[model samples]
Target: MVTWLGAPSVAALREALHEVAPQLGGGAIVPRNLVPDAAPEWSAATAVLAGRYVVKFAWAEPAALRIRHQVRVLGALKVSAPWLALPAVVVASESPALLVTELAAAVPFFDVRHLVGAGGRARVAQDLGAVLARLHDPDVLAAVSAAAGPLAAPVMPAATDALRRGPAAPAPDARWERVAAWCDWTDRVLGPAPGRSGLVHGDFHGGNHLWDERSLRLELVVDWETAGPAEPEYDLRCLPGDCGMELFGAVVDAYERVSGAALDRDRIMGWHVRTVLDDVLWRVEAGVPMPDRRTAGEWVDDLGARLAGFGVGG
Candidate 1:
């Protein structure tokens, strides 16, 4: 059992890395917290070693387990999908739960999301679709499951429950009628049966990808802590809402071309609804201010606009 090591300072993490992998000892270690808004005690922290590699270390036990699982998942993918542009794991330590990987030579997807033109977006979308198709291949999923054990499946209804119980729960007022209507729409659309399932990057979003601006391609996918079994649509949930429907449609088209299978657009939209509302619910519950200090109602309005972009909601 790994002991909880409380949150580590840059100096502490550097020392731990040195003790475990002495060859990596000499470097200018810069601390980067993956989730800056997280509680200090449970911050997801990493140390950049000499600008060439990143050392992921966990401060809490739960975080340690996730790191270990990610190490296993990556190890399996290294063999099953060697061509994938994943960060190569250099070393992993069990005691202090440290995972060292090569730093990807690209920028976060967010950096180029709005900067890219239509052609660039199409190229990126195509690449993303092909990558996800390969990742969700049946043989690759089998290999990952064998190595990493059973992965968690996404629960679609949980988002609705969260909104109903969270601080954003609708009250008997016209201002919140939109929220109530959204909940009803989700219930009516999602139905009783679950959608098709496959291996998914459970937390797939712009922030988790590395993009090559010159090539207009995805260089690498990082932060696989939440990778597991779910509907393939789960991975594409953020695209339409965050990046726009055109890019999302391009990705789906590319995916169908590469995988020889058509995707259900409605199913994708259903997951999109869950993803958008879940974001709103979490921010309101945690008292985290939205972008532009927008009110929760305004965020809901944005969600409605995103749905309308897909020609779905009002």
Candidate 2:
């Protein structure tokens, strides 16, 4: 009985969680944390249950694409052996677009961009890697494709059409400098396109992964809404590419190990840098502001640096 509505309003969480976990009593339902740092993408508020569960929801686009992607991913898991130690979906209401998945007795992995730490990091890396590998298996891919192939929200009609023309719009930046300033390894690494065959998680990174709470082990890699068929290297492009190399390295290494197939080293490399510019560009377009409206200059510099690194002097 919660009718979910706009995020950012404190009352929303109260009313929503009360609806989800009525037993806790209305007064006890309170969000543990609120993050205003995240812009148009998402804003979150968490409410911890009495030694039982944690309830959270995005004030951005909750019951829409989130539900769709989750449902789609869950549907795939039915046929695929992901062996994901994920929380069970307790009760999901499609009308208000609220999903009350069991909170893992776990914490979000803590690695730099990952959700885990040193010891926890390795375990999560291995476990998540294993799950992803199975999810990518040929049979699973085929089955998933048939069940629900790469899907973007029906609202974003051009998502698929845009990919064929080349990833949506290279990270919101015009210069693409984020990658260039990072390192020499980037240019040599991001070469030609890798073969595109399997389904991609699309937005693969730490902000979304969580460790299982009960055993303190990493659970299923949640947040699969932006999934779809695309070049295999597509997911790797989202990393921050500054000093987060070690984190990204762990993810890629673990992933290749479980998949039993060498990821195109070059392609993954390109993703490292490309995503930076792409993100910047997206932010500008989405009306997210840079501290001083200097995004244009920033982008040009970023691109220049990248070209210089790649030896593309022009």
Candidate 3:
């Protein structure tokens, strides 16, 4: 579920949905044209409706299994959040590899960048971190997973193979070699810190988060295509890796303040490396130009340096 709906012939997907939902019969479903206010970087859909609920359906290959798993996880989180703005997944169908979630009235975290200089950034940071920390709590972990059902054993080497063989842009032979070596190193180091792993949101980049600029309120974290159990640090790395430490320092500090748990220096750097490699692999596999890799690499290197500065090494 890490990769997203490319120019997937939505025709196949739409056909699948129409068959399963069947409510689209005869005439038009008005929400068919209803796109969300903000678009997620990694998904193809905008909105759908079954009954009165508004849903956003994200498509993915090999998503049949992951979507099944996510419906349960989000269902539990729906209960866990209680009063907060959280999405309750309504349907997941393998025919189109879709997960339908209740749509919320928030903007993408990136879309609200205009408010970053305002007081809202800090509060958003606090809320984001607190949410992750709260979800990371051991009790929360057991409850979420027990409700989600059994987790698939994460296969680092297979994933590494997918990386080398999948969508990231092709580097010079030299860079590819370096990336391959780093993958091996990551498997050895980062893979082990997956202790007490629960449902990890594999992708938590700003593009996936929704927030209210005026109130600094976090809305639905829309993309669960990558949601499931893994390492806690892996999820922690999600924020720092994508948003840059300057933006995420507030989040980390806020989470630490409330959780009273220190971030593991070892796992932080290790997972940071994993995130960097993942971006690289994604660009390469997608057959995008290599220059895009250089640009993304600069950002990731900056992120790596920041992670190391967080006292994370190895």
Candidate 4:
């Protein structure tokens, strides 16, 4: 498993660039930090090289395998979905833990400071729906699996362990009890369904999506480090409340229209709730402060309200 210690200093990065220059198709490479200064230890600090390529060095040998997996997935996509704008794999190395790819001319949809009008929002929803449709397609999944080997094990166990390691004890507050109950509910309801699995971009929220401001389209999808096989709902979970329920509905409607299948509302809702709880657990374990010091009851209430709006309920 990868453990973060600290980012390499400018000098260290410079030495790394010097070493890898030959593999990069050689130029006077300039390194720019892809990670923000405030990011936590779990995230890797990537570098943009020569203004055209992005390079990420893993923290450990195990992490290097993860990068290799992503590279294979990208290579497979290059053949299966040529229309999708994804980074082209430039170089991958197991030793010294490196993966490099060409940079796409796009920005995460969340980073767009300018307001998008209703038309723009609809377009974004439709684009996402269609791409997600492709990702979940049976044909695409088979092709990617054949090319990249099977997706790795699910990440939930590690997440659960992290949550349990938090310092908070049950006696101090009823919040732990509430959290326990939520976990119990999730276990009973959210187990994966056989034959329902598909290719999932493990983190498919707006923050990971890159929008082409000039073309007004989703030109590229970035951060495939966690791509795998999972229920289709894993990708849709974060999208259900984006913009507003209306836009969420637009995404769902478009997805149904494109895929010729009804959205699995129950499963999606269950995964969304579990995802929210997992996020809270991760934050707590990381020693990061929670918003309003969120309690279990409050989280449940919020979940209830959000689901009700989508015509789903306990």
TM-score of predicted model 1? Answer: 0.88
- Local lDDT at 244 for model 4: 49
Cα lDDT tens digits, model 3, 1-314, are 23333334445445655665655323222345333332343334544443444443444544344555556666777776554446665565544455665556677876775567645668777888887777677776677667766556443323565644434344434434345554565566655535665555667667677887677678777666566666667676656655666766777788788788866645655566666666666555665543324654564456446645764442
Q: Which stretches of candidate 1 lie over 4 Å from their true place?
A: 1-6, 34-42, 154-157, 165-176, 291-297
Assess the local accuracy of residue 254 in candidate 1 as a C-alpha lDDT between 0 and 100.
91
Kindly give the stretch of ten consecutive residues in candidate 3 with the minimal lDDT sum.
25-34
Error of 3 at 313 (Å): 10
The order by descending lDDT is: 1, 4, 3, 2
Two-way lDDT contest, 2 vs 3, winner: 3
Question: Which of 1 and 4 is ahead in lDDT?
Answer: 1
| Local accuracy of candidate 2 as per-residue lDDT tens digits, 227-260 | 6666666665543243144555676688888777
Best by lDDT: 1
Each candidate structure's TM-score, on Cα atoms with residue i matched to residue i, is: 0.88, 0.61, 0.69, 0.77
**Candidate 4 similarity to native, TM-score:** 0.77
- Flag regions of model 3 displaced more than 4 Å: 1-19, 24-61, 80-84, 88-98, 153-195, 289-297, 304-314
lDDT string, candidate 4, 1-314, tens digits = 23222354444544555565565544444545444344343334577776778887654444556666677788888898787668777776544456677888788776662456776777877898898877888788788889878877346423333443433533224444444544445555566553466788888877677887776688788777788887776678877544445666778788888988777766665667667666655555566555548564465466656766865534
Off by over 4 Å in 2: 1-27, 32-51, 56-63, 111-125, 146-150, 153-194, 212-217, 238-254, 280-314
Clashes of 3: 14
Candidate 3 yields a Cα-based lDDT of 0.58
